[model samples]
Target chain A: MLAVQTIADGLVLGGLYALAAVGFSLIFGVLGVVNLSHGAIVMMGAYLTWFVWHTTGLDPLLAIPPVMLVLFAFGYVYQRGLIQLAVDRSSLLASMLVTFGVALMLRNLLVLVFSPDFKSITPGYAFNYLRLGEVTIDLVRISALAASLALLGALAWVLNRTRIGRVIRATAQQELAARLCGVNARHVYGMTFGVSAAFAGASGAILGIVLPFAPPDEANWTLNAFVVVVLGGVGSPSGALLGGLVLGLISTATSQLIGPAFPNAMMFLILVLMLMVRPAGLLGNAFAASR
Target chain B: MLAEALARHRWWIALTLLGIAAAAVVPFVLMPFHVRVGQMILLSTGLGLAWTLLGGFAGYWSFGHTAFIGLGAFAAGLFEVNALGTEFMRTDPLLGFALGLLAGMAACAVAAALVAWPILRLRGIYFAVAMLGVAQVLSELTNSIEAFQGSLGLVLPRIPAFGLRTEAVFYYLLLIAAVIILAIAFLVKNARIGQGLAAMREDEDTARMLGVPTERYKITMFVLSAALTGALGVIYAHSLGYITTGSVYRTDFSLNMIVYNLLGGIGTLVGPLIGAAIMVLLTQVVLGSFLNLHMFLTGAMLVALVVAAPKGIMGGLAGTWQSWRRRRTAAP
Candidate 1:
């Protein structure tokens, strides 16, 4: 019974992790830029959702669209204004530094605005729970998990079916070739960043109901996203889902078998080990593997 | 070859020694607060140089060099506190410190060597992130493990200062550490290994194809860098007189090392020194009042620095000097 409960909980957590990481993986797969500020953006989304819920008494789930839209715009401008400049001036590595700098600045901003206190969304259903056999689960987590899966599914459809998706894919595989085919590479990159931020923000909104979050939690989110990408591979929603599920399982198992405090240590240990053993991840780079 | 390189940079060498001599008088003239600032500069310089051994020379930008710093501090702390016993530490504080420093360096060296084989296989950003994972794992373990006492924190013995004030003593200690680190970097930069590292950094596969022993050079540099960083970390822990996992295993310290190297000049001996001096002055002296805005300003400066002068202050100056020299010769 405990094992079943743990698995259920792990799957729910995994759903959230996948949703959080999919955007980061997409950006890495498409632009090859590790946006360290990704966590800050996620935090921004959470705070925005929390603010909306706090002030207007709107459902946290309903706030996702607005939060994501805001983040998407912010992401696009950030990519075009600063990250693009850094990459053009120096190398990809220096661009990493730029993102890191922005991450710090954004974190500072979040702290100033949000006061570094943990914030969570508690809807009327927050106290509600359902029991199936010996396993008990909260309504908030179930809703969060449902929302995460729905968003991830939506992202997968957009990437596979949309005209813009094909263009983005083309640019990822061959930027010059895409440009020759009249694809605006820069615009594609910016759009990809925007889409990534939108998804990340949506995840933040979902996560707000599941976990309490503060400014410093940004680092953990970023690392968690990185670990997810590494585990599942990069650039696709399915890959992120697979990675997140695996990570969620490992995390829960570690906490259950070892201790609660050891999960982070175990996660990082596995991150290094996974990198050493299989750098391409389980699914491999979805877009670039063919190349 | 070493002699030839020394002869080529004799004037620069003289300037460094002269600068050191001038710095020796800083403790006497400056306030304790300023001396502490000096201590920070020296520590940063030493750490930056240590990082440069692998990062600048071998082009493996570790995002978690603080792994060594934290490990070294804890290793020394544990050794001094638990292993050596309080009575032994009390009787011979200096000797205990020396032994603790040795233990710290040894621990870092061993840890680096163990991880080097697998971790070094990763390249660029992957390598950077993997090192971060390493640091995160270590810090988590230190905090969680009851024996490490990282969460509880450890108090270090106060060393005999030879009649000097505590701040001055630490300042001088860090100064010597920085100088030693600089000397090692300088020697490595001029050595045959340095040339091989340069080649490896440019193109590892090509360097390996040319029989440069890239793997050996990388592992050697990694171990050396970790050990040196560990040595500096031990002194830093002593200066603090107490340490938690948070204090020594700071992410900002890791970032600052890279920032210092970036702000000065990557792959240059004098770059980290200049960068450290400028940053320490800016943060500690200039913007000291605005503690809350520190991260914001540092981030802004980093962004501006990357966009405006990607090659860094030294690299920009070198470019100007090159053009000026070219123009002078062209006139003739």
Candidate 2:
């Protein structure tokens, strides 16, 4: 019964992790640039949702769409304005450094605005719980998990079926060829960043209900996304889902078996070991065939 | 051959000696705060040079060089506190310190060696992130494990030497460390191994095909750099007179080391020194009053630096001079 409960909890957490990581994975896959400030974007989403809920007394889950829209615009402008400039001016690694700098700036801004304290959203159903057989789960967690899966499903569908998605993938495989084929590679890149940021923001909203968060949590989220990408493979929603599930399971198992303090150590240990054993990840890069 | 090599770089050697002489008198002439700043500049320069051995010269940019820093500090701290005991440390504190420093360096070397084989196989970003994971794991271990006492923190013994003030003593020690690091960096840059490393940086597979012993050179440099960084960390821990995991395993220290190299000129001996000096002065003196804005300003500076001068100060100057020379020749 305890094991079953642990597994259920892991699945819920996994859903959140997948949602959090998908944007970073997509950016890495399509743009070939590790967006180091990804966590800040996620945090921005959470904070925005919180702001909306705080001001209007609206439900947190219902605020996700507006928060995501704001983030999409922010991500689009950020990519086109700053990231594009960095990529043009310097090497990819140097561009990564630019993102690092931006991350620090954004984090500092967050601290100034939000004050480094942990904030969480508590709705009307905050204390409700569901009991199925011998297992019990919170209503907020179940909804958070459901929301995460729905978002991931939506992302997967758009990428698989949409015209813009195909253009982004083509640009990722061959930027020049895509340009030759009448695709504005830069615009597509911006759109991909926008989509990524929207998803990140949605996850952040869900995360706000599940876990308390502060400005500094941005670093952990970024690192978590990197680990997810490394574990699940790069560039696809399915890969992120797989990686997130495994990571969530591992984290839950570590805390259950050893102690809560050991999960981060275990996560990083697994990260290094995974990189050494299979640099391509379990599923491998989605666009590896194109390369 | 040694004498010939020395004669060839006579002017460079003289300038270095002159700089050292000037630096030596800094504690005597400056305020205590300035002397502390000098100590920081020296420490940063040493760390930057150590990082350059691998990151700049070998093209293996590590995002977690602070692993060695934290590891060295804790290793020495544990040994000094537990193994040597307070009685021995109190009796002959200098010898205890020397032994602790050696132990710290040894720990770092061993740790680097353990990870080098699996890690060195990774290229580019993989290598960087793997190093980051290493640092993160080590710090987490230090924090979680009660034996390490990282959460509790450890206090270091005060080094009583030459009847000098604490800041002055550390300043001299850091100066010595920086000079030693600079000397090692200069020697390595001119050596045969340096040539091999240059080729490896250009193209690792091709360098290996050309019989450059790339693997051996990389491991050697990694161990050497880790050991040197460990030594600096020990001295820094002593200067602090206390240390926690947070103090030694700072991500900012790792980032600053890279920034210094990038700001001055990557893969150059003098670049880190110049970069460290500029950054220390900028942060400590110019922007010191704006405590909360430090991160924002540093980030802004980094973004501006990358966009405007990607090749750094030395590279930009060299480029300008080269263009001028080309124009002079082309006019005729």
**Chain A TM-score values for every predicted structure, listed in order:** 0.97, 0.97
RMSD to true structure for each model, in Å: 1.8, 1.9
For each candidate in turn, the TM-score is 0.97, 0.96
Candidate 2 lDDT by residue in tens digits, A1-291: 889988999899999999999999999999888888899888988898888998899999999989989899998998999888889998888888888788888888999998989999988899999999999999999999999999999999889899987898899889999999999999999999999999999999999999999987787788889899989999899999999999999889899999887887788878878876677789975533210
lDDT of each: 0.91, 0.89
Best model per TM-score = 1
Candidate 1 recovers a fraction of native contacts equal to 0.71
DockQ of every candidate: 0.61, 0.56
Off by over 4 Å in 2: A286-291, B1-5
Report the poorest 10 consecutive residues by lDDT, candidate 1 chain B: B128-137
Fnat (0 to 1) per candidate: 0.71, 0.59
**TM-score, cand. 2:** 0.96
